[model samples]
Target: MKIRVTGAFLFNVLCTISYTCCGETVGKRPPHIVMIIADDMGSNDLSYRGLDQITTANLDAMGFNGIIFNRHYTEPICTPSRAALLTGQYPIRLGLQGEPISAGEDRHLPPDVQTLPQLLKELGYTTHLVGKWHLGTARREDIPKGRGFDTHYGYWNGYIGYFDYETKSAMTITSEVYEGFDMKENFVDAWKDKGIYATHIFTEKALDIIDAQNKDIPMFLMVGHLAVHTGKNGMVEVADEKTMNNTYGYIADLERRRYVDALMNLDDSVGRIVEKLQQRDLLQNSVVIFMSDNGAQIRGIFHNGGSNYPLRGEKFSHHDGGIKNAALLYSPLLEKKNYIHDHLIHITDWLPTLYSLAGGNITSLKKTDGVDQWLSISQNKPSKRKNILINIDEVKLYSGVIGYGGRYKLLNGTIQSGFYDSFTGEPQSSNKMDYDIAAILNSRVNKAIKKSKVPGKHLDEALIRNLRKSSSAIRNNSKCNRGTEKYEICHHFCLFDLWTDPCETENLIRQKSKDDIVLNLKNQLAEFWNEVSPQTNKPVDINSDPAKYNGTWCTWLDDEFCIKIKTNNQNKNCNENNRSTSSIPVLKL
Candidate 1:
């Protein structure tokens, strides 16, 4: 009799497993999603990440309630990060080896690659993007509505003096600067510009969108904020340690009070969104996510704006400081709280995860570089990546290298360009030197060169297909030569924990690893490189004349190309100055 009862119980469990395997997952119910991204906020910039000086209470609250991923990652910079997130494909795969659109032009997502939003929209979910949209130029592809999103609002360019109405007005005509595109352009001029602050206005607009979307259909809102990207003009001047000024830094400078103000405004934006969810009684049903595009720039006059603490380097460089950021998953479906899920998730993973939760049929969807983490999360399974990959400006690796397996975050840059740590207030230093790396830096004779012939990894057919689609969308139809690119090689060492050094300050790349481990990592890196090296690099399209500034402040020393940006100003009609209207309604959250 006892055996018969036990057999009956086993039979019931098997039946349940059969139902799930047949695709009737869980209760077979879909979940709603909201993904919020912050621009240029470093991995440790927020209070939630344990910053003592800053206050991000609301985000902290969210962190407590949701599962925080300590190892969330993004591409080294803005555009490529966004591109990766949108297409679930690698930037190199899409041939976007650098910044998204060129200086003064428009680029579109290749029509072939299917973006996350388009997939959700097809599944009957409403989609919207508010705040910074730098993945491509909206100049001609002006309306993102043409892409995957159902609604969109934000700047087309990377940075604008946040509060500079004049510059904003100028952008509508030409992408040039005025006498001032400074954050103080308003306060420095705001005393006269009347009432306008980009931070305040953009937040208002987001909330408005959220409030109006409270109807019956499920939704997907990609809220990318420019709060911390840059204030304007450039990074704020370090007036002094006690009084930090705002040129418009992402986190804030030393002026802890005002920094708190800017931080509060961002929190206010989040709080309002939370309130909307509660008011609509949708808090429990909605899945909220937040992250940053890349590491914050932590050097020079812009030094004090914010810090990534222990992480090395800043935005644009491939370092932990530049590539790491906060990531979270908030769902009422979870039975746990105050948990830290120590796993690695890349920016490109958003599409598939959200699509699956939203009841979207992703099987028929186009290819993506990101793996669906939903199954792992709900079941508490292990991570998909046993090996992680990284690429910075002019860096490369080889394939089948052994020790590269397991978990690691690779950092690559020549000795001269070590990463800067804002909290430590210094550029990282090493006692020893790579004789090979130093040799390349020691000379500059154009005629004497040794061609490197190491083979890199090759992409699988599926990854190649989606990458091509994403690249074609943004590049339109342009052929680019990638022969000019160069990359430095380094072990995938994010911040190593050395055995001999108790303080753990040493980098394990050359110090602690066994010779065999190093060889293996090299091989794995080579495999990744082979797969990505053949890809096309980014395209630049500046409409200005380079000859205009033979030797002037208009020129920036780009390693590969001396980027010369000359301003061309034109007068607006007299009617424009006098014409005015009431404030446009701002969308909340």
Candidate 2:
């Protein structure tokens, strides 16, 4: 006997089954998320990226076993990139596209903006932040605790001394330089941990959070490391004497050696975090993301002896060296692993992508400029993003602007008069030893196979190694017509095919066939400029001086509020005695 069912009836039956399965899946716990951000790290800083001087064994292992983001982009500075990461929106929309939020500046991420931690908390996950919180501190409501995290264990300023934990700030109001301790633990001064190195301290705190997390409840932890960034007085803080003396003696440049020491310490932190997750039996259900905030400051303010060699421009320019960052994602959830993702990815995409991965409805994220790239990343699908508005800050010194669409990139104006638009770093031949790519690949691949859930599956180590080498070759390949000429400031406009000339060595403005591409990019920039909000930067408030608060950077405005209220009450009493109630001023509070 043959039976035929109506199409509508069959479809209704399938829909009912799908709904039932979805309901059951929603009751299960989501994956744990651990995001680690490095400060002022360079594109070529990692050994896997062809920097022969430094050895990042742990980072290389993660890259080899996970997905290496070859074309990831971030803001050219600290605060903007961070803001974009947490809010899933362009910094221009949030008034955070200007300079970083300096010490005592009355600038911060807008209070009404929904942050990543806040969203994660709503999804029944515990959230913690354990590093730099350069977002804002003008009000008690601007710190990480107020923003969404359950706890914060780090500094509130941009950068601080590695050991002393002191931040030096030049007051915009008084023009006096003030230095004070800046470490904090959940809104209180963390004075006891002053002598400890920041990388070690932050790592310990992250591990503690992971260990204490409830297995039934998912966790979200963000480790914002202060390593690789310049410390007090613009110096790269090195590790202890014994470790430095035992290793990194091959490099003659003292500054570069110090940077390598700091970087290795950061790598150790990564390895420890992964090992801890494995020991806790959380490795199978955890997703780890590692990224740098922006490119290194090689030759400008806060120069850290870091390098973004082979890519033009440094920390503040609108070039690849400034915005193209080092990033990778590792997780058991990925269907495809041990490959490079060359698609365009912006920092803003993290919020929405992670939210979707946590089983949240994408429609809930309102007015977000970021596209959900979870499927693109996990399943190896094409990226949904077509164009990226890098940045347009009219308030900055150089009025720098950049717009990227398709294979074409358009730039207008420049940063620091394009002084950093040249390759700058320690020479590639500084070290006599060559990097052993095969050995690193083989080690990582074997470890990954041991931990694999699939039975009898093997990774082609040679193919993976070739993938890494080819990706590096493509990134460093430069086909430019101009030889030995600096990429000068683009006072008006400049156009280049980034696909062919990643170095920005050739200007294609005069080519008639490319006129349409230039016009389209300019239009995109104009559209972005139309929607930009006024920059939120404010002059440094002298009242924020730590001298008034026992040599610690506290929420000074909170104390100021109490003082103002007391004075207002006194004035009100005096006015009442004089029979002039209307003279009493009403405080806004």
Candidate 3:
């Protein structure tokens, strides 16, 4: 027997032989992951997604060339959605499910949660984040740099002025601007005061990171664009004048025109980054995914001017318009391109999927609410995701749970019919799914799943158990009603099938012989509440820490009240409010 070296010894010998004989080393390099998230972008914002008013050529191309997620869902707001994305868990589990991270509020992603960057870092990937980090900024270990990103350059709050880099706070009584590197290193006066539009500045910084990357190491970049979200003064504070004038020359309304201009600039940002990747010879080796944090602001809130027509509610509601977002995934590793995936994908799925794509084993990670659908996604196979527990939060004025299983979905306590079919770009009708659509998508995913050599079903038992519990408790308690006493079950509960009627025009709760379905959904909703509700934490008391706001009140000498200082030049006389006698200039509300 020729020495009979096998098993571990044989594997080591084969590895040595491959390294010596084959010029290539350590298998294939992991693909670089680029996750581009847009703030307040709607499902129909892109021309390809049925937007006749706006033109998003680059975004359209990415969708057309990549995989389109017709039914991808995110949290109804910004902070919770981001938390879900990073932690691969529902925001409720992270205690950040309630509200957005407001200025100076001492709350953040819990330190125990394993983030995407932290997982990728173990795989030897260099991680960098550019743009909105609204997850948290309360403690020193709560920010992006402290979490996992090797380098972070952006604001930690929700919406900031695109040009001024400031956000108006009722608590602060002034618009505070934050621009800096790691918050831990420099929390005070770290602004650059470049006066450039926020979108452009963020783009340049992203390019710099990409250009400076070492080719040997795989990279993961998260570019959170602050475009489309209204600025401090409203939506009119900033927009590329040249692009705005050129694109919407015929639009009469200034605000509407400005909104369109901001959208066009957002599209351009997408194109520029793709172009940069192409020029760097990294496009083919990169995986690019684009999605919105939540639905668009269609109701003119904060002077917003985007539309989510045909879909129901705006950003902060339980309607599909609020949770169902515009999303696409592109990569050379994917066998299927120019396709629409109708499978239910939640915001939490990205972390596990991406971590696996970067050569991580999903089974080795901390128990997450996400499932590894890499095989199903990359190859265009039928997604293994059968049910999705959207969210249940009592934090907002409109609070309820949304759950989907098979062709049926329930919103709150009322049940309706119909589901939005992304492939046909319309709502599914009757009790049947479009076979032609299924065939087209399934064939591609099946092939990819086969080639991946990984099992399509990567659901963890713990996650499944949790989901099963949540799905069974939808309308169990009357007190759980989102502060509304209208409904008998849970006061604010409304249910819809989403398969037969996508617009939620009819309620099937009082229908004939649907008690079993209604009871199961109620249990599901109740389970979510019982598990996630207790995790929600209260916001930190900003009044307890006055030192954090020192010198950060008025950085600009030309603010509305600052005009008094320029003419008077009396520094000591500026403390009119007596809020702080420390001599820091305060903006009188």
Candidate 4:
């Protein structure tokens, strides 16, 4: 026997030896990560998702080229969802699940929590955050740069004017666009009257960041776009007249027209970012995640013209439309593409998932509500997360939780009766519900074991039986215990099988053989709540006291700019006297 090593073979051998010696395969580099979050975008907002009125060519292409998550869920509002994504914990745990953080409020996301950027930074990745940072800006320590980002740009308020970037409160009003390398020392206002659109400015800076970053180290850029969200002072503006005129071409209704224009501009931003990545020859080596903080604000009195069609309820509710969001993951690194993965995913999960993709160990991280689903996502394998606690709206005392052990799902507290295909955005027939659920669950589990390198079997016969029985118990044991109220029989819960009824239109509370399921779920809810800490909403001192605004952007609290600005006047249409009188539903969890 003779062995011969050619020049090419020796080169390959040397490369392999170098990798084993230094953990690098010749010139290979880590993938860059970009996360683009759209504000107040709904499930059906994009044309690709069946919105007849809106055109989102770029987002549509993202979904078509990457993977679309048809059933991803988030909190019913922005601040909570962002906190969950950043901290990898439910908002309830961080005392951020209530109303959004107002401009002058002293409350903020706890600085001690380990954020996604902080983890990435520890992994030698440079991180930048552009656009809305609603979690909190009441203090310097609570801002993005303080929370692990290397560079921070954009507003610190809940929402700001598209052009002015000003946010108003009862006491003061100030434009809140600033940029800095460090929040504690170098923070300074970046845009006040730049004449550039918010969406466009954010994108321009994002491209600049990409261009300026060191290519040798991986980068994580989070563009938290303030598109399609109505401004705090009731302002609704979009691209300039010329841009609107040339692009959208005369949308009839004023509010709706501006909305479409805003959405279109957002699409343009995404297109520009992708184009920049392609131009830099980084498209194939980058992973871009596009998602909404929550579903679209479709039913507010001053509607933003965003749609969550085919799914019941809107923002601030417990239905699919409110919690379920439009989401997509794009990357050439993915084993599969151009497909929809119908798995249960929570906003908190992104921290662990993205961290794992960046080569971090999931088990070594602090405890969080999120489960690392990198394999399930990139490989199109079965999800390790089979269940999710949708939301616990303390205001309404309503909670929606999913138990995906078997085909059965508990809505408020009962079992679901029908089927709704989240992938197709359509309801299914009740007759084929059981068979369909079992088949899909089985196939995904088998594929995960055979093809994916991850370990976990979320669906098994024994687990399904136990989960089903528990859900039935909860429903049956629920009794009428009204305190200082009318003595009436109320189930206090609603049930739906997400596999069969993703729309959550049909309630199975009236169905038989569901007592055990309800009781178990109720018990589980109690346990989950045990981990949720209470929120402390520190009051904003908007009075003419300069001392009160020391740490916050509320220095303008005494300023009457809210009355002086013409844009504020233009927003009078959404004022208290002229606002829509349409009623928003208080969802039954």
lDDT of each: 0.49, 0.77, 0.62, 0.63
**lDDT by residue for model 3 (1-589), tens:** 5785333343334334422111113235667888889888766666555444544656655655566787788987899999999999987788877767666566678888899998888767788988888876655467777789988877777877665555644444433433212211123323443345767767887888889986556789999988888877677444456666665766656665676677777777777777677666676667889999998765544536655545666676567777888888867667665567767788888988887766666887876888777666766676667667667665442345444433555665211111221111221212322112222223322223223343233223343333223322322322222232222222344566675555444457777576777778778767777786444444444342322343133212112321223323343343222223323221211
**Error in Å for residue 41 of model 4:** 0.8
Better of 2 and 3 by lDDT: 2
Worst lDDT run of 10 residues, candidate 3, spans: 415-424
Which candidate, 1 or 4, would have the higher lDDT against the true structure? 4
TM-score of 2: 0.87
Give the poorly placed runs of model 1, Cα more than 4 Å off: 1-29, 100-102, 106-108, 165-195, 236-259, 300-304, 361-365, 392-406, 412-416, 419-504, 511-513, 533-571, 582-589
lDDT of 1 by residue, 367-475 (tens): 7767677655554556675555554333333111111222443343322344342123321222211222221122121001111111222223343233223312311
lDDT of 4 by residue, 424-522 (tens): 222121122121224323332222222323233333445433423432231122221112322211136777655555455456766678677767777
Per-residue lDDT of 433-549 in model 2, one digit per residue for the tens? 666655554553335434645333344557556656855775546453235656655766888777888877777888999888888887888888889998988888887876666
Specify the highest-TM-score model's number.
2
Order of the predicted models by TM-score, top scorer first: 2, 3, 4, 1
| Candidate 3 global lDDT | 0.62
Error of 4 at 12 (Å): 21
TM-scores of the candidates are 0.67, 0.87, 0.74, 0.73
Sorted on lDDT, best first, the list reads: 2, 4, 3, 1
TM-score between model 4 and native: 0.73
